[model samples]
Structures are given as C-alpha cells and as structure tokens.
Target: MANDTGREAVKTVPETAGEDQQVQERIRKQIASELNLPQAKVKTTVTLLDEGNTIPFIARYRKEMTGELDENELRSIEERLQYLRSLEDRKKEVLRLIDEQGKLTADLKASIEKAGKLQEVEDLYRPYRQKRKTRASVAKERGLEPLAGWILSQPRRGSVLEEAAKYVNAAKEVPTAEDAVQGAMDILAESIADDPKVRAWVRRHTQDHGIVVTAAKNKEQESVYEMYYEYSEPVKRLPPHRTLAINRGEREDVLKVNLDVPADKIHEFIARQYIRGDSAAKETLQAVIADAYKRLIAPAVEREVRGLLTEQAEEHAIRIFAENLRNLLLQPPVKGKVALGVDPAYRTGCKLAVVDETGKLLEIAVTYPTPPNNKVAEAKAKFRQLIDKYRVELIVIGNGTASRETEQFVADLLKELGRPELQYIIVSEAGASVYSASKLAQGEFPDLDVAERSAISIARRMQDPLAELVKIDPKSIGVGQYQHDVTQKRLEESLGAVVESAVNHVGVDLNTASPSLLGYVAGVNGTIAKNIVAYREENGKFTDRKQLLKVPRLGAKAYEQCVGFLRISGGKNPLDGTPIHPESYGVVDSLFQELRLEREQLGTAQLKARLQEQQPEELAPQLGVGVPTLRDILDSLQRPGRDPREELPPPIFRTDVLKLEDLAPGMELHGTVRNVIDFGAFVDIGIKNDGLVHISQLSDRYVKHPMDVVSVGDTVTVWVLGVDEKKGRVSLTMKKP
Candidate 1:
C-alpha cells in the first residue's frame, strides 16, 4: 500500500500469529453458528470487516468473498463480532482479577472461558468482586465463616446451638450464642447468594415463571395508559410494546409495577439444594436459605429479570423503528411533477410553497382558507393563480393542525379549477417543524418564516422522500413504536444504520445530493460530506468518481467505501451512473470489449438481452473477475441509474377528501398506512384521526403482528368497522366484513 504522499509503506504481519489465528477461527465459528451461515462465508466476511471494510461496501462490492451475503447478514455478523470480542476481553480481565486475588481455580477459569454472555461472566466473578461492607462481610470479619462452613456441611452429630456457641466472642461483637448464630447465617446467606449456579438457576426460574403486575397510582385520572393500570402478564409472554408502556407509566408515577415470583416454589428449589440431612443444622440452614432468597437473591433476580425485559423490549422497539424508517425512506418519489405544499393553520393562515419539477422553490404565499379569517374565496383565487403560474400538477398538505379542513379546501379548490390532472396528498408532517427550525433550513430559506420553510420541505419530501427526509432527525419522523422510551444512543445507532443502508442501496446523485444525503454514504462522515459539497461549489460537479479523491479529509479508504454508492450522470465514464465500483472498471472494460458493445448502449434493452445470454461462470475467467462480481456488473449495466424505490407503489393522491361524519359501517375506502405497531396499524383515511386496523382485523387468517401485513407507507383498501364521533376514533378492518 502507498501513503497519501506516494511513498510505499512497509506492512508487517503481527508476531502473535498463532493467537490471532485462534481468535479469528473462534469468531468465525461463533458467527457462523449464530447466523446459520457457512464457516467459509463467515471467515471471509469477518476478515473484510477486520480489514476496515464498511458493511455496504463489503455487501455490494465483495460479494464473492462473502459468498454473496447481503447487507443485513453482514451487519448482523459485524454486530455479533464486536460483542464476542468484547466478551472475550471481559473474560481475560476477569481471569486476571481472579488470579490477582489468588482464587483462580481450574474449574472457575474453565467456566469463565465457556461463558457466552457478559452477565454470566460477571456472575462467576461476583464472589471475587470487591465489595462495600455488608452483613455478610461484617459477619466474616467477626470470624463466623468457619461456623457458616460447618452449617453448610450439615453435620449429623453436632448440635447447631452448640456449634454456634463456640463463635460467641464479645470482643468481635458476638455477644450471645443467638447473635453468633445470626452472624453465621448471614455469612451462609451471602455465600448462597454469591454462588454463580444458584443465582443463575433462580434468575432463569423467575424469568420463566414470574408475572409482571401493574396497578394504577390514581385510577380516576384519565391518561393514555389506563389500559395498563391493572395489567398482569407472564414475564416470558410480555410483548415489547406493553413492556415499554408499563415502563413509561411507572416512570411517570402513574403506575406501580412489580415482578411476582412464587416464594414457596423458590424456597423448595433452594431447600432441595442445601438441606440434605435431618440434623439440627438443617433448620438453621433452611432459615438461612430463605433469607438468602428473600433478602438477597430475590431482589437481585428481580432486577435482572426487569433489566432483561427492558433490554429485549428496547431491542424489539429499535428493530421496529429501523424497519419503519427503511420502508418510509424507500417510498417511491413523485418525480417530474410541479408540487404545491400547504402547511395548514387555523387562526393564522395556511402557508403555501410552490416548487418546480426539480424541487426548486418558485413561489410562497399565505392564505386564510381555514378558521377565523375564513377567506375561502380570496384564498382559492390566490391558490389558483399560483397553480396556473407554476403549472402545479400535485398538491402536498402537511397532516398537522387544521389539516383535514385544508384538505377539504384544496379538494374544493381543485374542483373549481376544473383540472382533472391536479391531485392532492396528505403527507406526514412529522419532523417538518424540526427541519424548518434547523440551521440547514435557515440557510436554504433565510427570508421565509418557519411555516413557509415547512411548506417547502413538504413539497420536496413528496418530490424525493429520501433526499428531503434525511435532513431531519430520524427519531422525529414518528414512524416508531415507543422510540423515545428506548436508549437514545442505541436508537440513534440502529436508525442511523437503517438510513445508511437505504441511502447506499439506492445510490445518490453526486451532483444533486445534499450533504445530509451524502453523509449517509458508507464511509462519508459529516465533515467529509460537507467537504465534498464545498469542493463541488469551489470546483464543479464531479465528472468522475476519481474526483472524490481530491476532497479534503476524504482518503483512499473513504473513497473506496463510498464511491460505488455515489453516481454521476454524463460523467467521464458511462459506468459512473451505475453501482459499478471503480476497482471493477477494468473487468467492465474487458466485458464491453468482448461483447463489442458501446458504453452508450449500457441501459438499452438489446444490451440487457445480450448480457443475459452470457453465462457469468464462463465469462468471469476471461474478464478476470469473480462470477458474482461479473453478474453484478451485468445487472448494473442492464439498469444504469435505476432507483430501487421506483418499483414500490406510489403514494395515494386524492381528488376528494372524506370527512369523519361521512364514514359508515362497512364503507370501503382506500387508505395509506401511517404507522405500524405491535397490535395494529394506523391508517390515514382522509380524516382527522388515523383509523386503527387491529392485528386480528388485518387479514382473514391470524396475524402475528401488524407489520406482517402492512408497513409504514403501504396503501391498502379497508372497510370501516366502527366509528365514535364523540372521541374522534375510527376503527377499520382489512379482512372481509
């Protein structure tokens, strides 16, 4: 490898080759077993990841090396690899800590080495961990450890009281035989609690059989969590959404939560383990076992169970959020259409923005079409003038305050204009306000108010959801299930990964992409993204992928990671617009030469048919490329500059709006799914409230989860199941009524 200054840098393999090889093998085996993939594939993927290859890059460009593993599989392998490495590091630290204390037994060391999770390793090290003074430590200091050990042995010949009498020493705070017995019991209790196997058994038992019970702190107070006020469910069967809701309710002091474990069953299990003989010490030992459970083990185990539940819940929530964000971002963009965006308001006025086909702002206005002012005639006239002036083909109304009224107004206005081509869509305004108040939005529209900027954002989002939505924080997009309840750092990481995967999957236009969009490319960070944009401003639009090398802070590795995901049309090379990496250009050139086809015919149907006729295995060796790489190159050539999202169903645009009062039982209507949750999906049916389609109502057969049948941006036809005008709720069903 050569450095940036063009000097050859010496690369030396590490001297710890044997250890490195062993670690690599272990990681490969573990990942292969966990992901149910072949060992060779896991090995190659791990090697690439260890070599600092990005997930998207490895998945897209190194297909043969990884046996054609996709991004999701690679990401899973990457995440598990990091976790296992951390686990190994913790294991080493634990062994060293135990050795320093002269307590590293062979069995203990073996157990630590075999531990799969950090929690298990920590459990093994609990006895060796340094501690603050507790009843057990204090009792040990009083020299009652020997008595405790004798009690643990369950001596048949010795009387428990007589044994306890020997430890009574006033100088060490053991004044009476009873006091000495209590101290010995305390020591025994702590020992039982500290035993790794004992703790593990108890934790497993509680988690498998415990019931999570909740009660309302103030039942009369009306809140969204009323359904959970008297909730009780088995810990093992608790759903992630319920867990999050219970946690939030508890946090708000609106509910009292408890883990109810069977004490008698736990006592029986402990007694069976320790109380072996019918000696006087048996009763003492039994009493101590109960103390161990009630005083120490139960509390610790309860906390562990709760933590496990929360962790599982958070993982599920994050997964749902990532899935929703992916679907939402990948929604088909309404391209090549002039759009008019409306940010609806009541007392103020509806803010409007008109953008050309390329999302360039052409006009901005505020009209009093709703509420107090109610200048319907004047507002319609102004909107008509803007529509005629910009030749607006579509209208995007933000689904916020007064949204339904504004939609009705627009529907009426479109009818008055007598233009059948003009249609309107109620786009989700989630995070639009946040984007408007952001520094990026200020830079883009310094003269506009927050509402006006929001209107423009709405317009552009319809034009290209991925490009416009990337500007706002993903969590603010409102496509998640209890997103705020999860760990923010974890949620951010998962959502960021989702965004990056989606952005890379649908390659970005190098010339037109915003810094926010480019920042999500495989290896491009915010600074490098900004540098690229600045470079474009200072120089000119990137004519070739190689121009990325000249951008500040964008080194060879970063370019290697991001180049394939950034496309340029009419650039130096015809393959620049496709997903063909620069490193594979040689093979592509060979392919083109062998086929006797010009670069300009890359995306033609004839070229696709010709390429389809050639077998990859036969042509790969001649082109000096792997079969997988050759196949990918052929596919890219067949569909140059293809947007993967263009295949999804387009957003439903409405020519007329329906009011809540107009909905009747068994009335069939088309709706756009707004959000999918565990139990149901919320669908926008052109009303004030999005109707709910319960999991049971999603299909004729049983539906395990709403996401199984619907996603965030899916368009589905449904029939009204019921309606409550007083509470503003609409119940809809997808199954046959």
Candidate 2:
C-alpha cells in the first residue's frame, strides 16, 4: 500500500464521470456476483496484484474470496478494470480542458459529471476544444458574422441578403448579394459543426449504422492502389481475416478504405439542433447548416467513427484467435506410436516418410499415384511393400490435392488385403507445407526434402496433435477466424499460454517428449527441454521427479513450478505418477497412514471410488492442509498418470464420404462442426462444402450465439434441410428430426 512506484496510494477512491455513488455500487455488485465474492471482500482498495493475488494464484486458491472464479473470469476482471480506469482518466482531462477555456458553466459541469460514457463527455467539451483553421475561420475573416447572426434572428419575410447588405457593406469582403449569402452559409456550417450535443447524437447514430467501404482506386489511379481493386463489402459483414487483409492492404498503399454513415440521417439531427425560425432567413439558415454538414462535420465524424470501428474489429479478431489456439492445444493426443505420412502431389508424385515411435524419420520415398499422369497399379504395389517392410500399423494420408482419389485407391487396396487390424487416419494438412519450408523445419529435417518432411509431419500429427502442432506456426493452422486481422503480439501471447497450460495439464512423458512438446511445459523452453531429453538419454530412466534438478540450467524455482505437472508413469512411487506436487508429498504420506494402508495398496480406480464416499472437507482437517489443496490432491490421486486431453470428446470419423447430392431434407445424421462464425457454425457432413447452421436454427429455443451450444471439432447431430451444390452452399439445422 506504500508508494511502491512513486504513484499516489489511496483507498476505495471512485474516480469516474458518474458522481452518483449508486452507479459505482451497482457495478461493484455485478463484479461480486460474477466472481462469487462477498460484498465486504470486494472493496475498491483491493488491487488484482496485491501480494497474495497473482491471477493464476488467486484463481487456484482463494475460491471463497472470488466466488469460485476461473482463470478466464479473473482475466476478464483484470481487462475491465483497466478499461474503466482509462475512461476515468480521460474524463478528468476533458473537464480540465473545458475549465481552462473559461466556458465551463454549472449546467455544463453537471452534464460532464452525469455522463455515462466517454463519448458524452467528449461532446460537452467539443465547443471549447482547439482545432485547425476551418471554414468558420475563413467566414469570420470575410466579416460575415453579423450577417450570419441576422439570418438566425429571422426578421419577418424579406430578402435576407437585402437586409444584410445594409450592415454588411464592408470594404473588407462580401461585395455582392451572392457573396454575402455564401459567407453567411460558411459561418452557419461552422456553428452547426461546433454544437456539442449534435456531435454526440451523430456519433452514437453513426456507430449503430455506419458501414465501411473498401474499393480499389480508380483505373487511372490503379498504379497507386492495386490490391483493393476488386474489393466491395459491408463493414459489418467483413470477416476478421478480410478486415486484417484490407487493413494491411491500405497500410501498404495497395487499397483505398473509407468508412461512411448516411449523411442525410446525420444532417437531420444537426438541423434539429440549429435551425429554429419560420421566415426567409430561417430557410437561409437551413441551407447554411446543410452546407456546413457537407464541408466540415461529416468528414471529421467519419474519421473518428472509422477509427473506433477498426479498434472493435481488431479486438474481436484477437479474441477469436486466442479461443481457437486454446481449443487446438487442448485437443486429445493419440500418443506413443510411430506413424507413416504421405504428402501427395501430381508431377512430383507422393512423398512418403517412415518415422519411429519417437517421431524420428527413418526413411523417405516418392511414388506416382492418382496423378495427372497416373501409375496407379505400380504405386499400389510400392505402397503395399513399404507398409509391410516398415511394420507400420497406422497409415496417415494428408487431406490435400488428389486426396480423395488417393483415398479411393487406398480403400480398394485395403478391401483386397482385408486386414482389419490395420487402421488409417486422414490428417488435416493445413500448415504442413508452411512448417516444412520454415527455418525450424529445415534444421530438424536437414537431410530430407521439404515435401518428405511434410509427409512425416502429417503422420506425427495423428500420433500426437498438440506435440506435433507446437512445432509449426499457429497462424497457419487454418482453424482461426480472421486470424490475419488480429494483433500479432496479443495473438502470439494468448496462443503460447494456451499451449503451455495444456502441456503442463497433460504432464508429458519425460523419457520420450520431443523438444517442441517439452518447450510448452510450464517453466521450460527449447534449450532446457532439449537438455532434459539429452540428459535422460545419457543417464537412463528418471527414478524420481527430483532427478530433474540434475539437468543443466534447470533451477529449484523451475522444478517447483513444473514438477507437480510432470508425471513419470511406471516410476518407483505411485504418487509420482499423479499430479500431486512434491511439496504436498508429506500430507499424502500422512493420509496413507491415517487410512491404515500402505502406498503399495493404492490403486487408481479403487481410490477414486473411495474418495467419493469420503469427501475432501472431511479429510482436510485431518490432513492439516487447506480444503482447496485437499480437494486438488483427492482429484489427482484418482486419475494417476491421466492425460487431460483424452477427457474431451473424440474427433468425428467418416466412412465412404458422402456428397450433398446424397443427402435429403430432414435426414438426421452425425456430423462434425468444422468452424463457428458470427452468422452460425459450419458443419462438415462429409460434403464438398460445410453446411451452415444459422444462429437462429442452432437450437429449438432462441439461440443468441452459435458458440453457446457448439464449438469447432464438436461431433453434433444435424438435419440437412437444403443443399445447393451449384452455389456451393448447404443449410443445416440442429433440431431433432
């Protein structure tokens, strides 16, 4: 609480535009309700970073204080707090500026204080703000202010210019009736632009209704902006990927992007704020206001609104990327076996690689199969020999060019051979090519061609998705929604965290983990991961988790954070294979003594059943540990050497892949949901293009979001209501048939 960073230390200070203590109380209560924290414990003085409250630490412990908040909720709270604090700072700065201009009235002060949002505060301060030289300045220079005010007075039904000529016959400017009116209109336009309330109203309306325009520059200007030449779409409808692409295009001078709102719609509000008389001069005032809107306010508002829209778009894109990365990392691994991968191509034939159980490539080959120039019979003979010679149990086929044709060939061969013991998996080859050509991939497969390496990668993907995926750049994974549009740093950080958390949760097998897989473990990196693997190979199997200390550059702090998450299966102590941290090994030992059983007597399945009967709260006091820790210990004890990823539903598999033409309306079938978008989710029913399950049709009841019920890779039951193969689109519903 002391001056830790040379900043003022305060307690429960509510600094915001809203002076009403009631508003602050309501928001505080909302936070309390969401976090499940008591009102008293939810004091404003409590910083998220207060000594005992790191995000992960508070989320894991202090469940009562935070109402059982998970890591996601905790992160949301942190973000919201930062945003609210920024809004408060901006409000204070705006108030100070208005007061400095000496135009701060009691009414204005009250308006600013009662403002519920940042936009409202900005509106009230607009009239007093400093700006660049504009049309109003030019009109004032021409000595037209007197004539403009006279028009607003609306003197009964005479030519306003005739009246203005008498007072505005200045030698400085406005020599003719037309010139006088033009000068007056300029002043009125500037005044309408200055009106604070009008600006606020227009801003809100624009946000709700604005649509950005993306277009290539004119043909004559094609040399300047070529990339955006064919672009056209509503801003609201533009996906994350397109938004990023267009933004990058504009940034690099390849496109012209403009954000627009209905000028007529915005002008109506300005007219209401400024035009208020019923005479010829009143008509003149309206005309001037219209001009002002065209010449000044519209352009400025467009720029401001466009900036805000871009920011919102970027944030949404970043969040989507983060979510996809999390799910991908948490996907289940097949685990523990070597695989043979095939990267198929036409001219170069299909590249093949045989990898050992540890995923080290032992051999590589090329075969002509299902190609522009087919050698189907010869290719089949060669493949059959390789399968037998290498003792391969699983065959991985990359879902790439000529894949379906290759699949047909493989299926025919399998039926003829009739070996039910052998299985084959179709792997998504989304980022295989990208990884094979990357510097890291080159270093790993130095002696092999990129295509051959890609084949090996496809095989390994089936064996362990998370482990193999970590080696490739996540951006190229193809599961992301508008991935290219998100902020690069935020996308990387979030994905990296997801990978780390998933790796630690599953607890890697120290003896066999590759550097890529081990790098994602908590408190471990490429160098340390490689060192551990090398040391294990030199010294033989790890007898105890404590032996990790022998690895070079791995310190005590690293071991403490990581050892609990790394399980050594088939090790000396049964507890070592469980998630129970070594620090709590003493408590575990005591629990065994109290239960009148030896360590050797405990079996995973039996212990799980016993713990359900004897709950943790009843055991916490006896064990002399916190109830939270006791609960974690009990959960871990039951699932010794558990792979967390294996808990999720398995990926949907296809047999004799069907086309859209094969389906009928109201036909109920199991399908895998491939991707989720704002409009709805796309389900792959083994058709050419995935079918859309519109948000409205996602549930029988009102469904607000597709994600509420479905996620990418979910095996769901969907009814195909319509299919338009010609249009390459399909419609599906989640309703029961």
Candidate 3:
C-alpha cells in the first residue's frame, strides 16, 4: 500500500534498543564463529577494544581478559568487528532512504537486514538508489511506465505495440506507436537489470564460470610480464599475484584483459525469471531481456567481478607484506659490540662510520676500496688503524652499490689482520637512504652528511635491528610483493601495526630509545613521543615510571596504556624494570612475602629457579591474579629488563666472501633470507645479487605458500641449483640430495 504523503514512519534506534541489542548479539556470535574464537573471547575483546585499549596492550597485558589472544588474532577481530558495524550502519541508511520513498516492504526490509555481505546489501539497495539520467529515466519521463508494466505482465490478450499506442504523445517525445514501444522496452530492460536477485545470480554464475583472458598489445615486446603476455586462467584458479600482475600490465597498456562469460546463459536466466507462458508481450520482452543482459548487466557484472578479485588480491598482498615486515623487524639484536659501518660506493668512496657499544658516533672516514679509485693498500691501512685504535669488533656493510667489492676488501683486510673475531655481515640497506634524508635523521645529527648518517644507521641497525629499523618507513623496508601496486593507506596501516607490535614486544628502554622507537609504544603518538624526549632532555633521565605523567599531553589514561611497555632499568622500584604493571605490585609484594624473596634478588639465578618451580596454576588463586598474568609476572621477575629478541639466533658474520663464478650446481652454502614473497624467498648468499629459492624448490614436500617454508631473517642451508654468470642470476633450492 503506497502512502499518499509519499513517506513512511521510521523508528529511531533509541526507540528500538531491544531490537538493536538483538542485532548486536547476532553480530557478536557471527564474528566469534567466523573467527573460530570462543564467544566469550569475542565479547570480552570487543568490550576492551570499545573502551579504547590498544591491540598491543590487550595482547600483552590483558591476556586473561582476551583468552590470551595474540596481536594478530586481536587485530582480525577488530577488523571484522569494524566491518560488521559499518555494515549495520549502511543497512540502517538504506532502510531509511527506501522508507522515505514509501517503498519499504516487510520482505525487502527483512532481506536487507539479514544480508551478511556488503555486496549483498548493496545489490538489494541498487533498485532504490536514485538514477542519473539513464535511458530508462528518459523513457519514464516520456510517460511510458504504464506500458512497460503492461508489457512485463505478458498478457495473452493484447499486443505490446497496441497497448503502447495509447501513450503516443508527441509533446512528451513519443512520436509514434513504434517509438512508444521502444521506450517501453527500454524501461522494462532497466527494471530487469536492476533486480537484486537477477544481479546476485548473475554475479555468482560469472565468478564460477568466467575466464580471465589476457593478450599482449605488442606480441613481440620483451618485458618482465612476459609470462602473462598470452595467459588464460579459470577465474576460480587464478592466484592473487598473477591477478595483480595482469592488472598492472593492462594498466601500463602492455596487455588487453577481459572476463569471458557466456552471454546466452544470462539472457536465458532473465527470460525464465521475468517472463512466464508463451504470450503476446513475449516477443517484445525477449528482445528487452537480451538488451538488458548485453548492454547493462554484462559490463556491470564484469566490473564487479574484476573489482572483487582485485580487492582479495590486494588484501592478501598486504597481509604477506605485513608478515614479512614483522619477521624482519624482529631479527635478533647483536648487542654490546663496537661496529665499523661501510656504506659501499665506487667514485664517492665507501663512506665509513664507527659506532661505540651505545651507538654513539665515534668517527667518520672515507676510503676507496673499490675501483674508480683503487686505493686498496691505503684503504686497508686506514681501516686497520681504525680497528686497532678503536677496538672495533664487527664490520657492517651496506648491501648496495659496490657491496660485493667492499665485502671482498674487508675480507682480505680481516685475513691480513689475523683477527678471528673480526667478521662482517651484509645487511639490506633498503631504507637507509630514506632515513638518512628524513627530518628525524636531520634533527638527530645536524652536522653529519647523509652518507655519514646512513653509515651510522647501518652500524646501529646491525647492533639493534629493531631499534634502528623502526626509524624508517615500513614500506621503504622493501620486504613486499607488489607493495606499490596495492592501496597505500591500507599498506601503511598494516605495516605500522607490524612495527608497533615489534616495538612493544621488545619493550623500549625509556632513557635510551630514540623518538622514532618511542613513538610506536602503545597509546603514544608522534607528538607525545617527542614531548617525552624533550622533557627528558630538560630534566634528567626518568627515575621511575610515574615521571611519564609529567610529559605534556600525556595524561593518566595515556600513561596507563603506555607505562607497561616502557621499562626503566635501575629505577626506584626494581619491579618497574620488569614487564609487570605497577597496578599488580600488590600481588608481586604478596608473592615476595610468601616466598621469602627479596626485591634485590630479581634477575638472580636463585629467583629464576624458584619462580620456575612454583606452578602458576596453583599459585594464581593465592597470588590474587589470573594464571596468564601471574605466569607472565614470574617470567618477568626472573629476568628483569628482558629483551624478547635476545632469545632468537643472531645474524651470521662472514670472515670471507664468495664470488658468483664460485657457485656451481649442487654446491651447498648457508644464506640469510633477505625477503619473502608470494612466489619465493630471496636469499643473500654473500654475492652481489641475492639468489632466488622458488616456491617449488623451497621444499621437497608440497608447499602452498613460500612463507609456509621460510621467512625474512631465517638462516637456512640452500644448494645451488644453477648459476648464470652473464645475467647475474643464482637459482638456489632448499631441497638437498
């Protein structure tokens, strides 16, 4: 029943609280089931997130509240929760808009309310969305809507043309019966095209049956995308990487891509859905159905299909990049070593910086070890003098221009110097240049040149990878597949999360952390991090955790969120240095009283043994804390100021370098995983170019993804599968004979 006023009454959510709660409960249950989490975990986690708790805080400190959900799991719930909530908001808006037009039926409202996917909801609302000067709108303006409806009824009594003749008015642009009939058909075609059920069916059918076909614009052109020059794959079988590759090629005008589907099937489905028995309007309606599918429906569905595929590909690519970045950032730190850093170059001469154990810039030197200036003897004498005088323990080389030659020089020098402890490592200086020219770097070292800053960065990075790497943009770290091809906002958000998780995991040193590392701590933004640094400089070092409150704009709430992750060694309270929150000091004191242990005994071997012997499951109730939290506290007390990265294996430092010509098929060598991608892992085997371990060769067993076998910073033994000296290609395999 249409309202005369052309509007229907709508209930505000405040008036529908009970119904709103029911919808929320459904959303909670759906998210829990979809994520394979306990319903209680979902409920508790959502509540914590809603209260503005950061993921790192919840994941690290509130383990009991979230059932010990890790950062990744918590983030997944957060994403899905946001999507479901946004979907709810969109559903309400759609219902209100449809009601404003007085067309909100019970069935339509129910269908829209029950829709799970955003696409499904959009499909249902497509019919009610206002049109923008379409052929159908033009036909309706010409007053042929009634004739279109009559034609849709498909009555056996009257002819379509005869019925259309009555609406033939020249003033409205309907010149004759044929013109009116054509206009009526246009209206019918658009209506059929907009039907939600028809679009939904066609979308699913095309996705399941369509073929992604691509052909080169110039068949003989040579490019990196040659594999996709003449490619055809079933839509369901296409991988994310290949989809992005073909899309990039098509964008660059190197390829023509199309989604191929059977047009006849769509026309047939439209016929069976909107038409009934053999009747008078069947002839006119049949042509309209074909026109609708061919003109309106097919192109639209193709775009939707392509868009969905692209969205999925981009999401997967971002996830992979995030994972790789996490692994790279968490590479174990090489602590307490005086390092000599070399930013390798030719004509500019290798820029050198010496950093003390505390990462202070000690000295800067430039030596031409590589050609354009073959001052090898002079370079060796200067390096030897520096090493002896400063007692430098490690040589860190940037894996950039002239790196191989630099490595060779350092190797020969170390051999001549006869220092068994002096070894060098090649680190990916991926974003070192970006950091060197950054404002943060400029403020940090005002007098230093960009190359000097880069050398210092490389040195500090090898000593403490997490601390130094956090200073650069995660995207510039370059452990990504098609990173530039995906949406940048999303990529930055994901990589930032990864960096945040890594920073909080290690728990930055309050006095020593740079502004870059401090910025990523939970609840601390860029401005607050800088203010804290400013406060520290004006005052002395923070003696206790409470001093954080004195920093500008760092309120009680921010302190509560960030304090647990900020450790102050040699603070007023010994517990301040541990991971245990100050709020739990009562439980710690009680535990100490029960165990008869002194606070000074923290980090002692006796304390570790005692803490390890006591069962957390048994002591949790007595301690008045949850088991997870109590266990964490015990571990923290046992090793105050613990760095999580300390537990992992350290990077390999080679005393000698190998040449690409030295590699042969079946030769065995160990390498560090520089980057992991969808197709394979790039292994740095002490050569100019890193070698590739293809996904199929990563293991002898069946592997679905390369990440399943290896990750960035992994040290594994790889056998040379082949070597191309002219092309500078080294193909390696993890599988051994």
- State the number of backbone clashes in model 1: 0
lDDT by residue for model 1 over 1-737, one digit each (tens)? 00122111111111223455676678679889989999999888777766667788888999888889998998898788878887887898999999999999999999998898999999999999999999999999999999889888887797878888998999999999899899999998998899898999899999899999999999999998999889899999999989999999999999999999988888888888888859769889889989999999998998899999999999999998899999999999999999999999999899999999889999999999899999999998999899888889999999999998999899998888888999999999999999999998998889998999999999999999999999999999999989999999889878888888889999999998888898888878877888889999999989989999999888888888889999999998899999999999888888989999888887789998998899998999998899999988888998888899999988888999888899999999998999998889999988888999999899998888888899988999999999999999999999877
Compose the digit string of candidate 3's lDDT tens values, residues 6-80: 001111011223448877788889999999999999988877776667888889889988999988899888888
For residues 1-737, write the lDDT of model 2, one tens digit per residue: 00111011111223444455564565456556766666555542234333223344345435556656666766666555545555656777888888887888888887876775677777777777786787667778888888888887777778886876764555766677777777777777777777777776776776667666777655457453465676566555666545666777777666788766777866667767666756777777767767776777778777777666666767766666666666666666666655668887888888888887767777888888776768988888877888788777677888788766666666677776677756665667889999899877887888888898899889888777877887887778777776666667677756665566556656777767777777766556567777888898899988789899999967775565566666787788888888787888899888877776567755655666776666678888888887777888777776666777788887554334465678888988777776676668878676555689998889988776677888776779999888787897889999876
**How should the candidates be ordered by lDDT, best one leading?**
1, 3, 2
- lDDT values, one for every candidate: 0.89, 0.70, 0.88
**Candidate 3 wrongly placed segments (more than 4 Å):** 1-19
Deviation in Å, model 2, residue 129 alpha carbon? 5.5
Deviation (Å) of 316 in candidate 3: 0.7
Model 1 poorest 10 in a row by lDDT = 1-10
- Candidate 3, number of clashes: 0
User: Once superposed on the true structure, which residue ranges of model 2 sit more than 4 Å away at CA?
Assistant: 1-58, 61-65, 88-130, 137-196, 207-288, 302-325, 485-501, 504-564, 570-576, 598-606, 652-670, 684-703, 717-737
